[model samples]
Structure formats: C-alpha cells, structure tokens
Target: MAGESTGKKKKTGMKSFIGGTILTDERISRQFPFVVMLAMFGLALIMNRNWSEKTIRQIGDMQKELEALRSEHATISARLMDASRPSEVAKKVNEAGIGLKEPVKPPRKLVVEDN
Candidate 1:
C-alpha cells in the first residue's frame, strides 16, 4: 500500500508540472502579438531619430559648402574686375611681348571737303 501511494504522488506531481507549463505557454502565446507590436514601434522611433539626425547633418554640410562657394565667387569677381582695368590690361599686354605703346602726340582730326 505504501508503494502504491508513492506511485500515485509521483503521477500527481508530473501532472501538475505539465499543467502549469501549458497554462504558462497559453498566456505567453496570447500576449505575443502585443510584444511584437511594441518592438516594431520602438524600432520605428529609433529609425526616425537617426533619419532626422542624418538629414540635419547633410543640411549643415550643404550650408557650409554654399558659404565656401559664395566666398570663392566673390574673390573671383574682384580679381576679374581688377584685371579688366585699363592700366592692368596695358601691363598684361606688355608682359605678352606686344609692340603697342602709348602715343605721345595728340590726335589731329582730318576734315574731308565734299566736292
């Protein structure tokens, strides 16, 4: 009788263990979709933050490039203006080995009498 009672207790213990695990599994399965939705929402938030940061960084780089380009344009425009001056043009022409020289005498107007 004692041996039979021990066997019955062992079976009851195994049945309780299995029953507890099954209940736990059912609860977990019921909540699985909620967990997945929360995880996806968190991932979306992280991606949005990263995308905004990257876009802001790109905008900053473009602004810096624009300022640099503007500065270069101003410098080139000034140089061009200086080079277009009459004195500067004469100096450049002389450096090119041209034979042109400033005239010393005033120009005289020629009048043709119509016949």
Candidate 2:
C-alpha cells in the first residue's frame, strides 16, 4: 500500500511537470504554430547570415587569386619581352661561341606523288 501511494505521487508529479512546462496555459498552447513559425524564421536568418559570410570569404579569396594571376602574367610578359630582344639573343649566341658563317646547301629535285 505504501509503495502504491509513492507510485501514484510520482505519476502525479510527472504529469504536473509536463502540464506546466509544455502545456502552460490554454492560450499559449493554442499559439504553438506561431512559436514554431518564429523559430523557423530565426533559423532562416541565421542560415542566410552564414551563407553570406562564406560567400564574402570566397569572393575575397578569388580576388586574391586574380591578383596572383595578374602578377604572374606581368612577370612572364616582362621575361618574354627581355628574351625576344635581338641584342640579348646575339649576346647569348656570342657567349656560346656561335659563328656567323653561312652553310652550303645541296640542290635536290622534288618528286610529285599522287594520293
């Protein structure tokens, strides 16, 4: 009998806790949809902020990449300009002990082929 009374008391206590915390009152309980809707809107705003932050960081990284590419392009262009100069080419050729003599060529006849 004592155990039965204790069990009943425990069940009553559990019911009261649920009824007070979740159900609270008739008015609030009936407005459950409004609370849930507001929560969804809050989450949407947080998700939008996170997405925008990531997008902004990506754009910044892309800008840095573009700058790096431009710098590399400029460096390569400068090197090409330097290498294409006749004076530079002649200097390198002379340093490698190149002679400016013309080579003799032998004449040959071309034969036409039918495909």
Candidate 3:
C-alpha cells in the first residue's frame, strides 16, 4: 500500500516538466532568450506605432476631404436656394419657354334625358 501511494505521488510530481526545469535551473542564466523576446516585443511595438501614425494621417486626410465636401455642399445648397426664389424660377421658366400664356376656353355643352 505504501509503495502504491508513493508511485501515485511520483506520477503527479512528474507532470510539470513543461520548461519549468530550464527556467529554474541556476547554472543557465535566463538572458539570451529573454533579450531576444524583448527585441521581438520592441519591434512589434515600433511597427504598431508606425501603423497608428499612418492611420492618424489617413484620418486627417479624411477630415480634409470632409471639409472640402461640406464646402461643395454649401455651394450647391446656396445655388439651389437662389434658384428656388420666385423671380429666379419665373426667369428660368421664361428662358425655357414655359410660362402662363393666354387661356384656351373649352366649348359649353347641354344634355337631354333619354327614357
């Protein structure tokens, strides 16, 4: 019974072999791979910064585009507003040869009952 219990404990203790020994070993300093990992992390950080800067530039460009579009919209709206005035509409209708002219009256009619 004692041997069986010891064997079970040994089996349980053997499960943590996923680099724990290499990390805890005193003879090997954890510097070379740590520096490499830090370098990789630093490179990733630099690339992310570059990407964010490009995104910021794109956002700025979009803002400029929006302003230009708004200016065009204002110009068009002003033109439309002017064109909607009664005098301008009448002038344009006259230019297009469409306006109120002389009326053409229809003939009168009479009806009789049929039985």
State the C-alpha lDDT per candidate: 0.83, 0.81, 0.77
Give the alpha carbon lDDT tens digit for every residue of 30-98 in model 3.
Answer: 576887899999999999999999999999999999999999999999999999997887777778897
Order candidates by lDDT, high to low.
1, 2, 3
Cα lDDT tens digits, model 1, 33-89, are 899999999999999999999999999999999999999999999999999998999
Error of 2 at 51 (Å): 0.6
Model 1, TM vs. native: 0.63
Evaluated at residue 86, the lDDT of candidate 3 is 76
The clash number for model 2 is 0
The alpha-carbon deviation from the true structure for residue 82 of candidate 2, after best TM-score superposition, in angstroms, is 0.8
Evaluated with lDDT, which candidate comes out highest? 1
**Tens digit of lDDT per residue, candidate 2, span 2-71?**
5454533223356766777546655557899999999999999999999999999999999999999999
Model 1 lDDT on a 0 to 1 scale: 0.83
The candidate 3 region of ten consecutive residues with least summed lDDT is: 7-16
| Residue pairs of candidate 2 with colliding backbone atoms | none
Residue 25, candidate 2: Cα error in Å is 2.2
Model 3 vs truth, CA RMSD: 12.5
Error of 1 at 56 (Å): 0.6
